[model samples]
Structure formats: C-alpha cells, structure tokens
Target: MNCKEALPLIHEYLDGDLHGSEAKELKEHLIACPACRTLFKQLEQTEAMVRSLPPVRVPDTLTAQIMSGLPPMKKSRTWTDWIRKHPAVSVAVVFAAVMFGSYMSMWNDDKNLMVKGNDLQEVIIQGDTVIVPQGHTVNGDLVVQRGKLEVEGDVTGNVTVIDGSVNLASTAHISGQVTKVDEAIGWIWYKLGEIVNMIGS
Candidate 1:
C-alpha cells in the first residue's frame, strides 16, 4: 500500500484499532517507506510522551471556589432553577474553576525530578540530576521533568526538559529538537494539543 493509505492505518494502529490483514499491510508499507516509518515513529513518541505524564485531575477545591464566587442565593431561587436559567454562566463558571484548579496544581506539584523514555541505559541518575556520559548514545526521545539534564554523548531523538535546565557538553550530539520548558502554563497547552490529536485521529 501507498503512504496515502498507510497514514490512517498508522493512526488506527496507535489507537489500538488496527487488526488482521490491514495491520500486516500497514507494517509492510512502513517497512518499505522511510517517510511513513519516520511518521509512525514520531506518532509513537508523541503518544508515549503524553501517556508518561500523570493524569491531570481537577482539584476538589474547584467546587467550593465556584460556589463561593457565585452570588448568594435567595430563598425563592433554587440551585437547579438558577443553573437552568443561566446555563451559559454556569458553564463558564465551571470551566473557569477547572482551569484555575489545574493551574494551581501545576504550580504546586512537580517539585521532584521525573524522567520518561525508553532504552535509557546510557542515562545517569543522581538525585535531581540526569547525565549522559561521553561515548554513550540514547536511541529515543528523552524527557526530564523538574530536574537538570546534562548531555555529553548523543541523543538520537528529541530532548525535552520540563520545568528544568539542560547542559550540553561540547561533545554532545542531538539529532532532534531540544526543548526547555520553563512556564507553568505550557502543560495546559500540551494537554490540549494531545487531546486535539487524539480526537482528530
């Protein structure tokens, strides 16, 4: 099969929906086409990276915050009646509360170092610091969270340091993009993008 046909199958395979002979056909196409193989690998990395992060949950305080921000209810106006009458306002309040809760969690959490990747035998760990020694090579994407990453060898794929810092030695070689994420709000955008990709796929 051609790339045009294999593209959807790749997404379907990642989604765990591809099966039978269709899966075989897609595999054969990926093996034959370098571009498709690269795309599949990228999609795999994206999926793995997103899945490695802990699930974001709205904090319990969100309910109290939303309720406290609302105007005092009158004896004649019930909560259900108020919600029915102002559906849009209610939705907005809930959405705002959720966003605020997520932001709060993002700011308060992630104080410890976290690393996610595959085939990281070359990566060194010491307290909150991660190091890739000289002459070593990492085969896939490397992600470090709330820590420091020092690279002295080679990384074949992307390197993303979130809420952390990275130091690359003169001998360090990275084949893919390197990203340093310092902002707290970046998590929200990443989650949104992941959701969009999942829905579109």
Candidate 2:
C-alpha cells in the first residue's frame, strides 16, 4: 500500500476497524515508509491526547438553571436566536460555566496546593502551581494563568496553562488537550475572547 492509500485508512487501523489483510498491508507500508510512519505515530499521539481529557459532568440542577436562563427557542425564530441556536455557542457557554464553577469552588484559599478529593469536577488555581493529586478525577477543564499544572490524576477535560508550564506525572491520565500559551499578548487575546464569548452567550 502506498502513502495515498495508507493515509486515509490510518484512523480505521487505529480504531481496529480495518480488516486483517488491510491492517497488515498498512503496517507493512508504515514499516517501509518513514513519512507514513511519522504520520501514523502523530495520529496515534493525537488520539491518545484526546482520550486523556477529563470528562465534564454538569449537575442536573445547574443544567436546569442554565436552560431556564435562556430565552425560549421558537420554531420560527431566526436572526435574533442565533446565539441560542448556535451549537458552538451553547457548548462554549457550558464549558465556561463549568470552568467558572470550578474556579469558584477553589476560592477563599490562595496558596499553591494540590487537589485532595476524588471525583472532582472543577477548575483550580494556585499561585504558581496547580496539582491534580493522585487518584483524583476531574470531569472539567483546568486553566492555570501565570502558573504551572501538575497532573497526577485522571482528567476528562482540557488543561490550559497560560504563560506557565505543564507537568504530567507518570500516573497522570488526561483525555483532552494540554495547552500552554506562553506569549503575553496571546494570553490577553485568549482571555478577551473568552470574556466576549461568555458575554455573548
């Protein structure tokens, strides 16, 4: 199998959905072709990264409240309903809410510390260090601004560290992207966009 034929089947191979003969052929091609092998490894890494993000679990009551806060969606609604009707907007709202709630839960203490509980679903911030303790599980994304993120637990969502670093312990299991934005201007833009999205929503 050539690169052209092998590239498209990479996902199926990774998913274990390819037939035995097809899988064998792809494996052979990957072994013989350096470029294809690199692409295959990259794809594998991407899949692993996605599978490692923490899962976000919103409470039923919170869901009800958000739904109640939104204007009613009518079958005939158009332009004015764009914000509420847009799937991406809705997802962004939920993500922001979850992150906000997580950040709120960590209020009152400002010291650099680590997560202590199991089955958590909030964002935490420490002065310069944010640690997700061993055995702890976070169902929401984690954002650390001007600090570092140390993950030793299972996270089902994304981890974003602005102008800081990320350290994943041996036991760390993340199911989403781990992003680090080091540029000051980029961080400002990101924060601004976040604020705008929340306000728009």
Candidate 3:
C-alpha cells in the first residue's frame, strides 16, 4: 500500500479496526517506508501521552452557576423545537453557523485566536494564528490563512491551512482530514468551494 492509502488507515489499524488482510498490507508498507513508519510511531506516542494525562475536575457548583446565569426556560413554541424535529435541517443550520462564524472571525484583529470548551459547533478561522486549547472539543472545521494552526484539543472535523503550518500537539485528537496548501490561488479556490458548500447545505 502507498503512503496515501496507508495514512488514513493508520488510525483504524491502531484501533484494531482494520481487517486482517488490510492490516497486513499496511504493516508491510510501514516496514518498507521510513516516513510512514515514523509518522505512525509519532501518532502512537501522542496517543500514549494523551492517555497518561490527568483528568480534569469540574466544580460541584458548576451546574448551579450555569442555571443561575441562564434565563428561565419558557414553554413557548420556538424554532428550536422545529430544528430538533428535523435533523437534516438542524445539520444545515449548524453548517451555516460554522461558516458564518469562521468568516467573521477571520476579520477580527486578534493575532492569536483561541477555541476552548466543549460541545462547540463553530468553524474557526484566523488570519494570523488559531489555537485550539488543550481539553477543548470542537465540532466543526478550522481554517488558517497566512498563519498557523495549533491544535491541542479534539476536533470533529477537518483542519485546513493556507500558506501556513499546522501543529498537532500531543493532546490533539482530530476525527477528520488535515489539509495544507501553500499556493494563494489554490487557497482562493478552496475558500470559494467551502463557501459554495456552506450555501448549498
């Protein structure tokens, strides 16, 4: 198996999810390719390090604090109910929100943008730098333009870098593709395609 074919399967192989024949083929390729083998080893070590980290402890009054900060819930009919009933529409709404949030964040003046917390459903973008802090979980894509992306958290979507670099810290956990393009023209095309996808969804 080629590097391209084996790369995506590495995670599955590590999880013991790959079939026997596929695993054997990947193992053979890893033995023959130094680059792939090194990448596999790094990923394995990162996973081990993450597993060794201590768990975070939440405050006992966190629930009460959250409840106190929020407005009282109402029984009135709302768009939220409709959205819950239509999962497809809900997904589309989330996509639109992510796209919009990402686009807006790109315009901010901050050089270092950070995304932290759990159950986040927004795409993140930064013109200078984007940091996904450790222990955070993001449910959407991340885009970095003319800068860098530092991911030390969990990402449920893709990571795209344009004319920049990506650093996946030891604690980072990504469930989707990671893409980096150095060309300005290619980045423009990619942005256009992403916008089209957001609108189409």
Q: Residue 18, candidate 2: how far off, in angstroms?
A: 64
TM-score of each: 0.43, 0.38, 0.39
On TM-score, the leading prediction is 1
The true-versus-predicted C-alpha distance at residue 23 of model 1, in Å, is 39
Q: Which candidate's lDDT is highest?
A: 1
- Candidate 2 lDDT, tens digit per residue, 1-201? 888889667767766688888888998998999987866775564345324423223333444454575664443333213322343343344345445652322211233223322223333334556678788788766666556788888888777777667899999999987877779888888788779968999
Q: How well is each residue in 1-201 modelled by candidate 1, as lDDT tens digits?
A: 998888778768877989999999999999899988876775565455334333322233543464576664443443334443444454354345345531111211224566665544466766677888899898777888888999999999888888899999999999998988788788667567649967998
Candidate 3 regions with alpha-carbon error over 4 angstroms = 1-104, 109-127, 195-201
User: Which model, 1 or 2, shows the larger TM-score?
Assistant: 1
Which parts of model 2 are misplaced by more than 4 Å? 1-127, 192-201
Clash pairs, candidate 1, are: none
Tell how far residue 101 is off in model 3, in angstroms: 8.4
lDDT (Cα atoms) of all candidates against the true structure? 0.66, 0.59, 0.58
Q: How high is the lDDT of residue 73 in model 1?
A: 45
- Worst 10-residue lDDT window for candidate 1 reads 101-110
Which residue ranges in model 1 land beyond 4 Å of their true spot? 1-111, 194-201
